[model samples]
Target: MSDTAPADWDPRSPKVLDNQIQAYDEMRHRCPVAYSDYLLWSLFRHEDVMRALTDHETFSNGASRHLSIPNAMDPPEHTPYRRIVEKYFTQEHIDEFEPVCRANTEALFDDLPPEGDIEVMSALAQPFAVRNQCAFMGWPDSLREPLRQWIGKNHRATRAGDRQAMSKIALEFDGYISEQLILRREAGEEAPPDATTRLLHEKVEGRWLSDEEIVSIIRNWTVGELGTIAASVGILIHYLAAHPELQEALRQGHENLPEAIDEILRIHAPLISNRRITTRAVTIGGREIPAGERLSVIWASANRDEDVFGDPDEFQPQRNRDNNLLYGAGLHVCPGAPLARLELQVFMETLLAKVRHIELSPDTTPERAQFPASGFASLPVRVQRG
Candidate 1:
C-alpha cells in the first residue's frame, strides 16, 4: 500500500484474516513476489522459496530475518551455532523423548471426557507439546505455564508489531532462561544432559556459548517446537477427523503415517511467515532487488504453488515425492525436524491407538490461530475412546 511497491506488485488485501489459507493461495497465484510497505518483499512461488533458502550468500540469515535462530543467520557464522544446537536434538535424544512425549499426550488425553465436547487445543495438543518441550529442556514446572503464555503472546505481539509488549515478554523469558543457565552451571551439569546442556556446553568459533547466546538458542527451540507442534497436532487431527478414510488408514496401520504427517504439514504450516533479508543485489521473479531490504518467505503459499504441486490445495500424502519444503530447506531447515517428526508420529499413533473414532462436534468449527501461528487454536471434537 506504500510507494515502495513494485509496479507489478499487488498488495495483499487489507481484509485478509490470519486464519484463512485461501488468502495465501490467491497471493501465490496473483502476486508470488509481492511487496508490502511494512513486511517488505514476500516470495510465494515454490522456486522462489527454494532459491532464497539455498542462496545463502545473497540472502543472509545473520540479518536474523530480524527474527531469530539459525533461521536468521548466514553460513559460516550460522554454522557454529547450528552445529551445537543440532547435537542437542540428535536421533538418540529424540528417541529418548518418545516415552516422555507419549506420557504427556496420554496424560492429557486421559482427562478428556469419554462422550462430551472439549477444546482439544487447550486440553491436549498445545499443553502436551509445551510440557514435553519443557521436559526436554529440563525447565522447572514453575516455568511451564508462563512459558506457554509467553510463547502465545510473543507470536501475537510480533506479528502485530507491538514491540512494547513483545519486548516485555521476551525480556522476561530471557531472564528466565538466564536463571536456568546459572542454575545448570552451579550444579556442574547441563540441565540433565538434554538440549539445554548440549547447547550450553558446545563450542562456537572455538569458544563456549555465552549465557545470553545460550538463552537465545533455547528461546528459538522452545517456540519452534512448542507452538508449531501444538498447532500441527490440532490441524492434523481436524483434517483426519474430517476425512474418515485417512483416519481409518492411520488407525488400521494400513497406510503411511509419516507421509500423511508430511502432507498435512505441507498443507497447513503453522507459522504465517519467516522473515529474511537481502544481503546483496539479486534478480528474482523478473525483478532486481537491492540489499538490506527485508523479505518474508511465505511457507504457506509456497506449499500451495500449483506449479510445484498438483492439486496443491488438496492433501495427498504422496505429493511432491522427493522434494517438499515443509520442514524448510537447506541448512536453515529446522534442526529439531527429527524431534518434530517423532512427536508428530507419536501423536498420531498414540491418538489412533487410544481413540477408535474422531468426529467433529456439530455446529462447531475448528478455528485457526490468528496472527503468527496459522493453524488451529482450538478444535472441538468428540472421540470414541478405546
Candidate 2:
C-alpha cells in the first residue's frame, strides 16, 4: 500500500462545485484517476469506472461505515439482499404501481399555474418524487412534507461532510420509519398492506428481518427515490426547455420518453457519483491504488466521456443506449431502476400532454445543486398551456 499519490484536484472547490459536469469532463481527460482529499482516488473515465464496477473482487462496495443494505455490500453477501431488493422492482410490481404514479403526477401537474413562470423543482419535481414515493410505499400524505425536509437536511450534511450532523439526520429518518413500523405492529391484522408492512414480514435466510435491517432497507429506498428521482425530473425538464425542438418533438408523441429520458440524463446526470473501496492493490488508468483505499466512480463524468460518445452533449438515445451508465453497471446496479423508469416515463408523458410548451423563466436562471447532489436546485421555467 502506498500513500505517495499527491492531490490532483479539489472536488469541493468553487469552480468544480459551480459546474460539476464540466469539471468532471476536464478531470476525465486531464487525470482519469485523480486523487483528492474529499474523494480520495476519483475514477473519471468510463473504462476506469467500468473496471472498478465489474471487478468487484478488486474494488469492493463495502465502503460505508453504516450498513447500507446491498448498496455497500460485496458479492456472496450482496447477492441475497440484492435479490430481495430486486423483487420489489419487478415488472409485475412496477406495472401495478403505474396508475398510482400517473395519478400522483397528474395531481401535481394540475397544481401548476396554467401559463406563467414557475419553479420546476418546487412546483413539479420535488412534489412528484415525494408523492410517488409515498404512494408506492403506502406511506401517509403527512410524510410528504417531512421527507422533503429530511432530504434537504441529508444533502446539506453530506455536502458539509459533517459526520455528526449526518448521523443525527440519519437517526431522524430512522425515527420516521420506526413510527410507521410501530403503527403496523400495533395494528396487527389491520395494519396497512403497504411496502413498509410487507418489509416487516420479509424473511432473510430463514429469519425475520431485524428492525435495523428493515429501517436500513427503507432508508435506502427513500433516499434513492427522493433524491435521484427529484434531480432527474429537474434535469429532464430543464433540458427540454433549453431545446424547444426536442421538447416539441416529445410533446407531440411521448412514446419515446423512456429512451429520451435515459439519453438526457446521460448528458446531465442526476446522481453524481457512487463510492467503492479497493479490496486489493490495483493499477487503474496508470495510478496505483492500495487495498482499502476509498474511491468514487464519477457517473456524472463517465457517462459523458467523449471516447464512448462521439459528442458528449449530443442527443442520440439509440446511439448511446448501450453504454449509458445512468443507473450504473455490474452487480450493485440500482435495484429500483424499473420503478424509477416507469415513474419518469409516466411523468414526462403527462407533462408533455398537459403543457403545450415549457421555456426558461424570463428573469431567473436555474440554480445548480452542489456536490453529493446533481441537477438543478431551482429550475425556473415558463409553461404555456396546450
Candidate 3:
C-alpha cells in the first residue's frame, strides 16, 4: 500500500459545488493533481487528462463495482460490447432519428409561451431530452415522467455516497428497462422494430446477450442520453442568452450551429468528470499515485486548460474544435456522440428558426447544479416569437 497523502482539496465542499466550473479552473492551476476523500485523485489539466484517456491500460475504466456494459470494462471484454453499442449510434441510425428528434423539439417549442418568461429546464431542456430518448428507444410516453424522477434520485444517491441508495436506484432503473425487454419478448415476431427490440437480439462473443447485460447496456445509454443531453441544452441556451451577438449570429445562419454548440459545451461542460482506476503506480502532473487508486478526469477543467485553449472562455469554434474533449476521447469515448450532435443541432436550428430572441429572465436568477451534475438547475428565460 502507498502512503496516504494529505488531502489536497474537498470536492464535495459547498463552495466548490456552488460554482464547479470556476472551482475546477482554480484547481487546474493550483493543484492539477489533487487528492480528496471523495475522489481519490482528480486530474485537472488538459495534458494530464489526455494522458489518462489515451493510455487506457495504465488508467483503466473498470472502476465501477456494478456491471456497466462496456463503459466500465477494459479491452477484450469491452471490444465486442462496444461494437454492439456503436451500431445503435451510426450515421444511418442518426439520419433516421433526425426527423423524430426534430418533431420532439418542435412539439416542446410549440408548448412554450409565445413571448414570455419560462423555466428552460422544466419547460424545455428536460422534456426534450426525455422525449427524444423515449422516441429513440421506442419506449412509451409514460416512461418520461418516471425517467425524469429517476435521474433526480440517481444524482442524489451519488452525491450522498450512499451505496445502498445507489444500488436501490440502479435496481429501480433496471426494472423499468427489464419491463421493456419483457414486452418485446412477449410480442416475439409482432414486436415493434426499434432500438430496444434490436438489443434483445444482439449477440456478443457468439451468444445472445443476457437480460442483465442488455439492461446494463440500455441503462448506460439512457443515463447518458437523459442527463448529459439535458444539461447540455441548458448550458447551450444559457450561453447564448448571455451573448446576444453570438445568439443573433447563430440565428442569422452566419455560424455553424453544430460547431458553435460543441464549442459552447466545451466552455461549460455538461458532464463534469468520469472515473478511472490506476492499474499500476503512475506519476502524472508530477504527482505520484499508486496502483488501485481511483482517479477522476475533470472534463470541465481539462477542456478549459489555458495551455490547450488560451482564454478558455473565448468563442472560437473553428480554432478550438480539434482539441475540444466535449464527447471525450480514446477507447471509451462516447458512442452516442453522433446522435447527440444530431439532436442538439436539430434543437438549436428549430429554436433559432422559431424564436426571434432568447434572453435571461430579468427578475430571476439561474441556479447552478451541484457536483455529480453540471449545467443550470433552473434557467428562466424570455423568448420572442420569430
Worst 10 residues of 3 by lDDT: 1-10
| Comparing 1 and 3 on TM-score, the stronger one | 3
* Position 243, candidate 3: lDDT: 99
* Error at 26, model 1, angstroms: 0.4
Model 1 scores worst on lDDT over the 10 consecutive residues at: 6-15
List candidate 2 segments past 4 Å from native.
1-4
List, residue by residue over 1-386, the lDDT tens digit for candidate 3.
Answer: 34467889999998899999999999998999999888889999999999999999999999998999999999989999999999999999999999999999999999887899999999999999999999999999999999999998999899999999999999999999999999999999999999999998999889999999999999999998899999999999999899999999988889988999999999999999999999999999998899999999999999999998999999999999999999999999999999999999999999899999999999999999988999999999999988
lDDT of each candidate versus the true structure:
0.78, 0.92, 0.94
Candidates arranged by TM-score, highest first: 3, 2, 1
When 2 and 3 are scored with lDDT, the better candidate is 3
Give the number of the best model, judged by TM-score.
3
Point out where model 1 deviates above 4 Å: 1-3, 6-14, 65-67, 189-191
The per-candidate count of clashes, in order, stands at 5, 0, 0
On lDDT, the leading prediction is 3
Residue 309's C-alpha lDDT in candidate 2? 94
